[model samples]
Target chain A: MKSLLSVQSHVAHGYVGGRAATFPLQYLGWDVDNINTVNFSNHTGYGHFQGSAIPEPELIKLFQGLNQIGCSYDVVVLGYIPSAELIDVVASEVAALKKSNPSTRYVCDTVMGDQGHLYVNNSCVDAYRKLLSTKIADVITPNQFELELLYGKPIDSEKLLRDAIAYMHDTYGVDHVVISSLDASVLNLQELQLICCAVSSRFKERSQEQSQLQVFLVPEIKSYFTGVGDLFTALLADKLFTNNGNLVLAVNQVLTIMSNVLKLTHQLGIKEFTQHYGEDSCERLAEGRMNDGESMRFFELRIIQAREFYDYSGAGEFSAIEISN
Target chain B: MHRNLLSILSHVCHGYVGNRACVFPLQCCGWDVDTVHTTNYLNHPGHGTFQGEKNDGRTISTIIEGLKKLFDLREYYNVVLVGYCPSAEVMTAVYEELEPIYKTKDRKEGPVFVVDPVLGDNGRLYVPEEVVQVHIDFLKRGLVDLTTPNQFEMELLTDTKFLSWNDVKSACYKFYDTYKVPDFVILSVLIDEQMYSVGFSASTETVFYVPIQEIRCRFSGCGDIFTALLTNEFYSNGRVLSPQVLTLVVDKLHRILLTSFREERARLGRDPDVIHDINLVRLRDLFERSFGGDLEVKYL
Candidate 1:
């Protein structure tokens, strides 16, 4: 059995993101342990309320305790680090883990940016770049503005988004980069809006050639709940762990599950703002995309773009692995 | 002093089961629920065979007493009380009982009243005309701090058609002049007229006419979310908000709806799972987040 570890802001039964990310990992039958960075009373849906944050040292200690228990996760999904210190702690953890388990990879949900601006603390962007980008975070998921912040330029189109995604994948030495919530067509916002995109740079490492970039657009999902990014990373990590690390197939499987769940939400007439983040919502998703290890409908996603690579090495091989439970 | 907002509803859980059962997202922000009192008659606390069976005043009063005891006017300052659905009658009663206590004792901050007047939608009163009558009386007697009604509900209250932004403004002004409710929020409106103004009562006479930006699809509980957020914006800003500021809250809600639609499509028409995290009351923060969008606020 493969295990995955995810970190984000969890408010027990309160908010959607932490749990949204957490449950899907579990639903897919992966043993997932989540480390909450902050536990707000709930997802700041209520106007004013209170909660607490978990310190980085304590989080490190928690992982250490898990190690003592012989519980090593096959994948680690990191999201919304509340502080620069936590990012530092996570970077160190990723490095150490990768050393021991070369196959295990880190997926970073770069949640520091929102709408069209940066929302994370000013001190943390460099931490994300240096600590997360260089040494760890095999996969980095940043929305459009986040990509611009990382590249220090405006990403006006999908082409620009792809460029930024490729830049982070190569410069940071990460093979998988996903940019979400971007519009390819500015003139028509609706037609252009996409949920999320996965830009692949596997061949870039083998050749001096530019890495192959692929974009997987997540259907445009409202930022209603908190931990969706966390959930996406966890599912990808699990699929990769179970599948010899075939990032493409893994991305497809996870997307299928998310898309199916989103469709169910609409059928029920639930409001657009609050997408049921409760445990019950997971029950609706109670069933996972199954294919008897052959084929899954949700696994069939539209691949919007693919790039070619010739000479790329440190970037590693482009392989889609799927390890089934 | 700590303050809180309570969202009360009176409706057949089954009638709007989809709306009420999953309403927790609208009720609790910060995952905190002051109280949820469900009655049958969307606006009346204890009447009807509500939920289709009612006329039980004692059972309803007991619930009211329970709510009253849970929140003490003496302890909280600036507590805002909001009532929607068939529960408005009881909400009106709740306010009547609590208002004097809040005023005479001056112990806690005065409770702010925001009445959504859920009597109409899409320019027509959906509830029984009598139920709408109760709300009209509630507003006429001057019982709320702010009132928000869609074009239809506003017209039902004041009997006017919003032919243009100017017309909407005149009707709103007439309601205010006639009824004395200062802050009247027209929930969602679209116009082809000149997009002349931008945001807030930048100044009262300069009333801004923010040409509404249209985001498609209407899911349930929009009115509930709107009132909750608007009340927060109005009250938190010392009850004096720039019309443009409301755009931020409205925009977030619009996005949430769109996102939910995306999730729904992914799930084959299923509701988005994020609905679980929604508390009707905290919708304000959801819409007010730094990244949130704003309503195109404007006035005549």
Candidate 2:
């Protein structure tokens, strides 16, 4: 069986970070070792949370202790590192892991900021860039804003996005780059879809005019949810490890599971909204200004409640568009 | 009311034990489980050595207090499961901290506190003797509605040496009669080659004995798993009908243990990395058994 070392934040009340990702990977038959960075009462999107962050020295001690115990993993997934110092420590550890076992896969979720806002410290961007410069990570999943943050420019168009991917490949030597979300205006499509693009460092030589990007599109669910990215990164990394770097198949597998989860989440959220307020209160709430807290309470990813969807292997009607640019 | 549960136990990062062994099974049973970690470690200490700190009374009480402030403990959970209180300080803190909340709750609608007094196994105590004393004192206070202890813990609690079924039954009755705990289960009563568990419900004024074939395997967290299964089954079955609940829980645990052994054998066959004599599962199949409910049980 494969083993995964998941370094992320933990919440006692709700699912996010390690709490969100660990179960699905375990259900997929991987032995999971979870290192919690913060033991919070709940996720922070609720606007009220209480807990303490694990200090950097303690984190180092824990990792070193694992090493002393001869605990090695096939994959090390990094998510929600709370401090730049801890990020540095993680990078060094990942490098050491790769040096010891060249077959070990390193996946960096690059969880800095998303949707035109930076939720973590601005120093995290530098930390991520420094980690990427190590060239030890095999897979990096970053949203559009995070992609632009890495390249230090706005990827406002298809041309710029492709340039950024190529730059990451050329400069950082990372193999697979996954943009988990893209602005709909880039494609000029109606009925907005949550599209993810998977690009490989080994691009086709005949694709000077044809894009080598595999685009996976799923219909968007209109509710605020957290931990979607964490779940996506986990599934993507598991698929990549199992399939031996087949980006297309990995992306399709993740999308199938995610789409089902989101659809169920949205339905449950609407049901909760109607239950709490009245029949059609979800419509009333949807027709007005969106409240993130209220919407999130109704949504909350439904990760634990709708856990059966994690085993979905079919992509359904969703298929990848192999763009040639 | 909703089937919500609050579990206070140990959380291990690597292997399943304590809440790691308890929480997932309850969740799979469709209960909303909220957990407070008494301590967090890399793996069970039975693995030779482990890392992480013992979450002290202050830290634990703070987390529980935080939960109360946010969710109003009495309103949020219908079942409170306690296990492995590592220290007398922590045990006292847990009781004093939650006493007010339970007191405020309407008794008819309040949470049912089920204590698994985890002191020691195999004729010894793992934690300090004061921890055992604290547990006895807590039970003496009649705060817990249910308590599950193995033979050694039961012996320690009642301070009795039982050589037969009648002695063990009298010890259980004496415990309930003294502590006023409405329900008590003595997990593992050994007679000759067979092992039996005694479940007694004072409310129904009944007792039941469940015996299983003694499989020679050493695995951590069986006690924790059995406690979780008992808590959920008792709660869902309306806390009465002790015989039926105990039978179901024991049968499920036996089946899961068999599955774990089979899985371990299969794992050793495929993976050359695993050395023999290591418990491959170490309580890893809570989720696997969550969806498993088809085990046929013929109660003897």
Candidate 3:
């Protein structure tokens, strides 16, 4: 069985961070070991949550214990560290793991924020930049905002986006870079169409001069959902590893599964809202008038219900469009 | 509709035990699990060298309070499952937080409380002595609806020295009568080289024994996994302790253990005594499948 170490946030009451990532990876047949960066009552999008961030020392102690037990993994997936110090710890620990076993793959999800909002500490961007410069991560799944943050500039144009992707490949030495989701406005696409892009530098080792880039256009679900990014990163990591570094197949497979999960979540969320507060409440929800607690309820991912799709081997609804640079 | 469960247990980074063993299976069975970790260890200690720290009572209280503050425990959770409290203080914190919910309503209206009194096994005590006392005190308060204890813990709970099956029955009766706990299941009892899970319900006045197939190898998280499966089955069966639930839990556990045993043998070659980590991820199909087994439950 494949083993992975998952470093992320853990919400006791909801599926985000490790809670979202761990089960799907496990169902995909990976033994996942999780180190929770923060233990929260629920995701922060709820507007009111209670829990404490795990101190840096505690994080070190957990990693030290793993080291003492001689625990290594086939993959190490990093997501949602709250501060720069914690990210530093994760970087060092992952670096050590890679140094010890040169074959260990690292999947880094630069989880700073989404849609121009930064939820984590600002220093985390610099921390991630430093970490990526070390050339330790094998694959990185970042959103448009995070990609721009790592590139240290705004990627408002297609040219800038390609430059950023190339910079990540050439400078950070990352073999696989997947822009998990690009804002429709960034690419001037239809609002209903979500763009996902994957780039692979693994072909370079075969003496191929150019890297392969694949872009996927998938229909968007209008409803808001949390944990989508975490789940996507996890599935992408597993599929990339299982499919033997096939970026297009991995991204296509992940997007297909994610589309199914979001649709289920939306359907269930509507059913629950109508049952609780009648049909009119959904209009209020769509208008963004619901209170934070009620609004958060509508966004909880239907992870358990959508378990069957985790191992989807069938053809995906969306196919990648190869783009040459 | 899926039921909600509050699982208080240990969290390990490496292997399946405590919440790691319980959460995935319960979630796969269509339950939403909210966990409060009492300890965080790198792996199960059976590996001989482990690293982690035991959480204090304050941490437990803080998390539980956070849950209670945000959501109504009575409405949100259908079951409260407790396992593997590392310290007596942590156990006390759990009891203190949960006692109020039990105090407000009876078991029928409130969440069902299931405690796997994880003290020790094989005639030993792995936890501190104070932990045992706290468990006894919690039981005496009539707070738990059901508890699954092994033969060794059953002995400690009832303060009995069992030489025969009758002694075990009497201890069960003592537990029901004295603690007012409605149901109890002795996880494993070895009688005549055969293992059986003996379940008793005070409400139904029923006693049944579900035989467990003896796998040659030992495992670290079997008991934890068994308790999780039992909790899921028990709720699915309308909160009844019957021969059917026991049979399903034992059968599923049997398949998982047997698979783990076979895999270990294949990997390590016939090392019968080595304790193996049951790969629940590999057994995902087994968990998702509807529970079925041909094992017969013998009524006592």
DockQ of each: 0.01, 0.41, 0.72
Residue-wise C-alpha lDDT for candidate 1, range B78-166, written one tens digit per residue? 54444554444454565555456545533124666666666757755555566776676656765566776776777777788766767
Give the C-alpha miss distance for residue B282 in model 3, angstroms.
1.1
Q: After superposition, how far is residue A128 of candidate 1 from its true place, in Å?
A: 0.6
lDDT digits (tens) for residues B126-188 of candidate 3: 999999999988898887878999999998999986677788778888888778788888988
Ranked by TM-score, top first: 3, 2, 1
- For model 2, the stretches where C-alpha displacement exceeds 4 angstroms are A187-211, A280-284, A287-295, B105-108, B265-300
Worst window of 10 by summed lDDT in candidate 3 chain B:
B268-277
Docking class of 3: medium
Pick by lDDT: which candidate is best?
3
Relative to the unseen true structure, what is the Cα RMSD of model 3? Answer: 1.9
Error of 3 at A111 (Å): 0.9
Q: Residue B279 lDDT in model 1?
A: 26
Best by DockQ: 3
How large is the interface RMSD of each prediction?
A: 20.2, 2.9, 1.3
Worst 10 residues of 3 chain A by lDDT: A199-208
RMSD of each: 21.9, 3.8, 1.9
Docking class of 2: acceptable
